[model samples]
Target: MSFPDNTVLQSFPATLNHRNATIFTANRTDSSAQQAIEDLIDARLQLRDRVSAPLKGMENDLFAKSQPLDSLRPKLRVTFGRAKRDGAFDWPVEEVINTLGAQKRGAPVAGLYGFGYRKSALGLIQEFFIFTEMLDGHLNGLTWLKRERNIQNLIHVSFNLLHALHSKDIVHMDFWANNVMIDPQQPTRAKAIDLENCFLTPTDHLTEVLAFQFGFYYRREIFRFVIEHDYDRLVFEELGKYDGIDRRRFDEIYALSKHENISRRARREIFHKGTVVTG
Candidate 1:
């Protein structure tokens, strides 16, 4: 339970999961790699510091509580966790999300902090966790699903992850950068965390996740987030390169996202029940 130890951490793939992720093995002696990480760390710290500047800039707390993400119902094989420099540690939040009474939440894959889980050790079935540090020589970052062309392969995989989550009726309140994850070297490594505000549907409910027939406005948002961020890269030049689709699907989804009428369709799809998308 000692955080799988350095040997284990090093041996394990840079990442896991099929949603969207890129895990790279650590470098023992790479100065540039170390510097790039330092740069990212600096940027992250700067962003955190900016939180205090809200009045003149923005006034928000730097860190909040970490929450449990999800886990297997029948089997304990799955789990998830959310954390930053610090986490609020809300246990009952899960109850609210799981209560299908106007709210449906995922049971959890589970959330384990690098240090917390290791200390409080939850039963023998759990794996010891350590802070997912952006170590000097080791950097594990989320591949912006629709943000970069080099990681373009993640589009289909991430879409499927989103589909699977929606199928269970879990509403991901925050689906932006910090919420999304990816593995650059491995295929299908996308992840969405920070379930503090998530609403759940039902684990057995196929309607929540993507059914072939269900019309989730997800198709549209995926296009929006993508085009707005990484669409211009040379790799994304053609839509066909994606999981193999015609160019029109791209334009089609993008167009739908701009529709003011039904523009809120995606939001309503996951949030409110009676909310209607005008289009």
Candidate 2:
């Protein structure tokens, strides 16, 4: 199927599951949108042939036979399949569409290149494909940061992204260290990924949505530590043992995260100020 005019293709290598659907990336000579779709179909065919006669325990290894694709620019290709029972894609198609919307709206996210789907003999949708920019040379926030400056920079970047999303009334339901990726070359800039679970709501619901996310998400412990002591102690006294981020500024982050009105102007202030570390 021909994709929209905005579609562009590059190459990357990765294999992972999206719900029950299989997603993988491969290289292709053609950069056009239609050619990209055909490349994905060819990759799927190759995957099927390999899986048809699996080696011992190979079925259990999802990353088996994964190989890197060659390209000057890297792009991600995701494929989604339908479940037999529900006759629907294993994952929510709207999630991918919403992510594209987020990217277009200036949210810190991977750029969406294009998306298309395959249909069955009866014209029913059988599969879905999405193409996006590959975040090359990026490491998640959980990875090691060799310098105190790098750590401080990541914190600033993360909160700035959070505020950006909140300003659009979008709640990153799974905001955490691993969801934010940074490149050493651009230490202070980060991009958020895994936005499939993000939630959109009215501006008035922003604080409540943020509260819910905090209560149930991975970084709830950060707030707990902050309440018991303070953002400073939580950073310098506790987490400093791990990352050595002591003396690094976090006041703006603390104020934004702990503010009663989380989506208020404070977030805008921090975002507009372009939080950066000095000294």
Candidate 3:
């Protein structure tokens, strides 16, 4: 049996419920059997749910605005449902490309598209880009994680996974909370998504402006999403945990996060460090 490479597959539709939801077409697929299970874990963590998780009357209000997908140069169709059956494949194509190293058409996918773990794991959510505007107060996680420390696990997993990839020389151009997903119940291990704009540095060390930009954005998102999201929780969670627990955890998160210190400092070394700041 030979699965031909570079074969452009046509996507069909699967049933989904958009009622009282935000701007999105409800479809699922069957070919994404592997992703179904992976997405299930991600859905469990509620990363995408938090991002795309429609607001109260989000559907009613969404149509009022417009987006890139509204006119829709090229739209991706879903082909599976979460509740369809015991087994199904109905996740986004970006997810497919991440874990499966495949594509439906000539459309681009994230750099981590083909990067994934051995078994089922989460992937980034790309569906949010097709919008006129993002909803307000995605910072709602503050309220959700209020007075709880477990949420740190989610933050930890989301941030660290990207750092781990960066350590491997993968520069994730788009490093945002929305682009990462957490594995259900396992906050230590998460998945990175949206490689369409990501680039893997051929050389171990990348010394370009793009690397700096990627690092800067990655740093911003990690600080904003990971540390800020549940810093207090993590702090207390590590209370009496160990002598160097915090440092160890910090290193772990840094290793897994997509923000690379190398990428961040590489360009600066060439441009500003040596350049004299004349008064």
Candidate 4:
């Protein structure tokens, strides 16, 4: 799926209508997929009541959203609903590309189309929607890495993507292989998706304040790799070579698991220095 060479929209419209629901797009100048977006919304509303688990619901919703529509562009993807505990609907791809200046950094995120929301009879927000360019012939990183002939290239690109994000002070809390997309045709090409959990911070560590505030679990290995600015451990992990990890670093981060009340500043200091630090 290819898009014509047109200037990407820099701002979202105040509002647009699609039946009872309102619509928004990443590019206001691009007038397409309005009916498809509304159809996605309708399908999601119908499935919302039947699904219970958040992740499971999203899996089902992806299928629902993929229903073919004549107006839907072949390159477009419409995602509905927010992750559990998300306070508001945020267009992370728009923020990363537009606000953070990641467009030039080779930050592998899908091109945003826009988002929309529907309000209930009482004027309360009911459903949320997101639209982005589809990554055709791409598989999740986990599955792709297993069969990829040149695994090194994918691993290297993954590290580069992470470095680009970290340079902008953005920590992608869910940097797991499942969140990465790899194109088989272009083996080295990788893209990061599922950006709702990402956050910007100056420190290299996942501080206690930020973790609890965002309901993020303290992932020691992720924190270790982020602080060290290295991807060797991740390469091993992704390749299913758990025994290949650096035991010293693993044990060091593991030691902090039992200390629940450590202060945010202390946790940050501990991560940087690899030593117990008290606030």
TM-score of every model versus the real structure: 0.34, 0.49, 0.33, 0.54
Q: Candidate 3's error at 246, in angstroms? A: 26
Candidate no. 4 TM-score: 0.54
* Candidate 1 displacement at residue 18 in angstroms: 39
* lDDT per residue as tens, model 2, 49-167: 22111112222221112222222111112222322232221222434545665775787776654444443444343455555555666777657343433444555566666666766
Write the residue-wise lDDT of candidate 3 on 1-279 in tens digits: 001222212121232222112222223422342233234333433332323332223432221111121212122222111211322122233333222342222112222111111111222222321211122222222333442445454455544654565555454545555555443344344455444344344333233323333334445434554554355344334333223233443443333333444432233232333211111
How do all the candidates rank in terms of TM-score, highest first?
Answer: 4, 2, 1, 3
User: Who wins the TM-score comparison?
Assistant: 4
lDDT per residue for candidate 4 within 14-65, as digits (tens), equals: 4567655665554442233444455556666555542211122233222111
Q: List the candidate 1 regions with Cα displacement exceeding 4 Å.
A: 1-148, 167-169, 176-178, 202-274, 277-279
Q: How far is each candidate from the true structure, as Cα RMSD in Å? A: 14.9, 13.6, 15.3, 11.4
Segments in model 2 whose C-alpha atoms lie over 4 Å from true places: 1-37, 46-92, 144-156, 215-279
RMSD (Cα, Å) of candidate 2?
Answer: 13.6
Candidate models: Cα lDDT each: 0.33, 0.44, 0.33, 0.44
2 against 3, candidate with superior TM-score: 2
Alpha carbon lDDT at 24, candidate 1: 28
